[model samples]
Target chain A: MRNMLLLAQFEVKKMLFNPRGVIALAAFSLVWLLILLYPIRGASEFLISPDYKALIEGLFGPEVVSELFKWSVAELAIYWIAALYLFPLFSIFIAADQFSSDKARGTFRFLTLRASRESIFFGRFIGHMTIQTILVSLTVLATIVLAVSREATLLMPAIGSGALVIVNLVIVLLPYTALMAILSLYANSARQATIYAILIWAAMSITIAIINNYLPIISELKWILPGSQISLMINTQGLGSFAYAPVALLQTLVLLLLGRIYIKRSAI
Target chain B: MRLIECKDLSKSYGSKQALKQVDLTLDAGAPIALVGPNGAGKTTLFSLLCGYITPTTGEVSLLGHKPGDAALLGRVASLPQDATLDPNFDILTQLILFGTLQGFSKKEAKSEALRVLSLVDLAGSASQKPKSLSHGMAKRVAIAQSLIGSPEIVLLDEPTAGLDPANAKKIRELVRELSSKTTFIISSHNLDELEKLCGQVLYLELGQLTQSVSMDDSQQSQYLTLTMQQCDSEKLLNGVMELADISSIEKKQHNEFLIKHNSEEDYAIESALFTLFKQNSWQYKAILKGRTLEDKLFS
Candidate 1:
């Protein structure tokens, strides 16, 4: 347990505290700032306007659009559409090279000498989650503040709903980040991991679409693409906040287990 | 008690075997030198010992536990052949992280890093990034990292490979000083340095340990290399031939002779030769014991 924590501490410092990490985080924060202050705020206003209300109702169905009047739930609709898609993209760039760069530079030679292989693998995974939490927290805070300004009495409920938004968004990224961790094990460098991440995402999406037509029985295999259940997690479809949480958690555990096996046997 | 035990340990990558059928048992607190040519399995053996790689054919143990086991967490450490530090962090910060993994508290870890830096003569370079330091300085910092938490078994592969002569000598001295507390398995191509530092020598070739010599008992004192003035060579050799302890003498180099005596401790022969050289007015240089590692390996 202590070794795991120590590895996590080093991993966090590598991804969030270094100069490159600082630059990446800075750029990400700027993008999130724009997201919170502009489109996110604008989407809420436009969806409720009479000109677009019918359009949104028709697109999303009247039952789902009716919940937008409730301040606690309205922001989730905007937050989901804005943050959920952007979160996975943001995650790929931030954690693309987490494991690969260490191997490329021979740093793992020293690391594996003292710490257990499992500690290093899981520590890096947890460390990526930590960055995910930080980014999520800041974005949610800005969105809640914007929601509170437009409706003063909605502050308390906004906090609760905002908490749900961050949890759901973060959970949705876990399996994806876990897959990236696995990618890094095979990649030569972080840059290669980043490139592989985008290519793999597109390739998997195409494969899932193509295979679904002929092999409908294995439709559930689409979940391997990561973030496939984002809509289920955000739950604009009337499922509970945690309906997809267990599946995401299960996928994350399975990917992490595979990573542990690979790292143990693979040459550092 | 055996601090390390390996029986028929072997490792292979694809068809290339790095180590084969190796066997060894060692106790604690003795500095052992590993001498070998490049690609001679020195690094592979160190990796297996430190748990970076597992043996393919045999079992191995460190401090009576598996090499990578948690029981040996603070007890074993290594200064790998590669000195690549994370260019992002300063030396002190990295050492603190290493110290933390070795089980020191944050504050204690910092102090320990500071202490080790001081040991390696890099007290002022604590805040310096690894990229900012020269290869030699970076190597020292890497050495300092291994010394953290006062590890009992420290495996150093070419610890001073890139250092200047002076720094290399100092690191040797540091190893000698630390030998009292830590058991060191140092692999280096510098036989002279190893001869001066190590108590035992293990010669590895073609993925196998060919010979192991205990340096303390290496010199049998029956032979000595005697160097005298060029003009006095004949006179000194002829005079020394008269000594009662002498068995045979051969002129190896100009004014140098390889003298074989009758006993392991040739004190009587040495004293007799001193008198003979003084009488003949020959400048006597050094009268030393049997062959060095280089001589043994080459011969």
Candidate 2:
């Protein structure tokens, strides 16, 4: 247990200290600030153009105009999309290189002194999750600050929804992170694991769309893909409705289990 | 009791066998040199011993515990070949992190990190990241990391590979100083370096243990290269060969001979040869030197 904690702590420190991680976080925050303060003047104009507004209302209902008006600092924050996709991308970049790079650098043998495979795997997983939480929190706080400063009459109708959104986002992202971790353990090189992960995700996405289009018998397979589930969760909640948390939880658990099994059986 | 023992261990990757029915025993308090040419299973053996990879067949035990059995790791520390440190971290932080993982308290990790870094002569680079240091400094940092928690078994693979002559000398001296307290299995391509620090040598060739030798068992001799005068040199050679305690002789050139004699009895052989030269009224020149370990290794 102590060894696991130490491994996790080191993982966290690595992410925090890495210049690429720091720069990405900084860049995301800057973009969040721009989106929050100038949504109508800038971003919302592009998303809420006459044609888009028609499409929005046609899809969501006429009240989406008011929904657009109720966009809080949190709503303008990109973390919702960022956490769903961008955060997972960063998680891949941070972790896909974890074990393979260690092997490449010849450190995996040395690291075996500190802990066993089980501890190293779970410990790094916890550390990466911690980093994700911290990055998400920072982006959320920055968005709230920008919202409060720009909009003085802030009752923030979607504040509760925004919090739920982030929670669901994390839940959806966990499985993908676990899968990437397993890929990292199995691959001999970071590039190979990353390419494998991206290709898998792409194939799953295309398969989900194709299944959704024609297959009545296995159309439910679409929900198994985390990306499809996440899109459903986002579209459902974005229009002021709650998603099925149990389904999301179940998918997350399966991915985590698969990841653990892969890591346990992996050679390195 | 043996601190480590391996029995018919074998490992293969697909079709390439890395280790083949290898057997070895490491006794307490003895530093063993694991010497081999490139791709001769040195790293593979270390990996199996350290529990980074499981053997395809056979068994390895560390102090009576199986390798990779969590209980065995507390006493067994390994410095793998070319192990990389996290380049983003300072040496102190890197050490502290590893120490803490090995079950040291935060305060203990800090102090031990400082002490080990200094032991490796890397005190000045404590605040520097690994990327900023030279290859030799980074290697020392890796060595420093393995010394944490005073592990009983230290497995160092090519520890001195990239070091400069001075740094390599320092590391060799440190290994000699530390040998009394810890058992080391160090692998190197440099036979001279291993000869300087190891009491026992294990030579691996083609994934098999070909030879094992004890440094103490090889006797040192006083060797001489002599030039003989032309008084029928065969009679002179024949006369020299007839002396007692002369170990061997080799003809190096038309008129020169290389001679070896037990050091304690060298004087007797030299005196008898000198007497023969005077009686025969022959002329000769001789220069003597101490025998080296390399000569024995090849011999």
What is the clash count for each candidate, in the order shown?
0, 0
- Candidate 1, residue B123: CA error in Å? 1.3
* DockQ agreement of candidate 1 with the native complex: 0.58
Query: Best candidate, TM-score-wise?
Result: 1
Kindly report which residue pairs in candidate 2 clash with one another.
none
Per-residue lDDT value at A47 in model 1: 62
Off by over 4 Å in 1: A59-75, A231-239, B227-257, B263-265, B271-284
Candidate 1 interface RMSD after superposing interface residues: 1.7
Question: For candidate 2, lDDT tens digit of each residue in A1-268?
Answer: 7777788887887777778667866776676566455652344444535686577678877753434534443344334544565666666765576566776666666667677777887887778777777766666655555555656554364365457666665665576667777777778788888998888889987887787788868888867765555544443445342355666567767876776676555555
Candidate 2 lDDT score at position A34: 64
lDDT of 1 by residue, A70-157 (tens): 4444555687777878888888877777688778887786677667888888888888888888888988888888888888887887
The total of clashing pairs for model 2 equals 0
Model 2, residue A15: C-alpha shift (Å): 2.6
Residue-wise C-alpha lDDT for candidate 2, range B1-299, written one tens digit per residue: 57989999999999999899999987976689988789999999998888877899999999888887888665788777667776667779878877787888999999999998998899888999888999899889888888898888899989999999999998888888888888888998888788778888888877898888876663434676667765676776677777877777776667767787764753676777779889999887654443334444555
DockQ of each: 0.58, 0.59
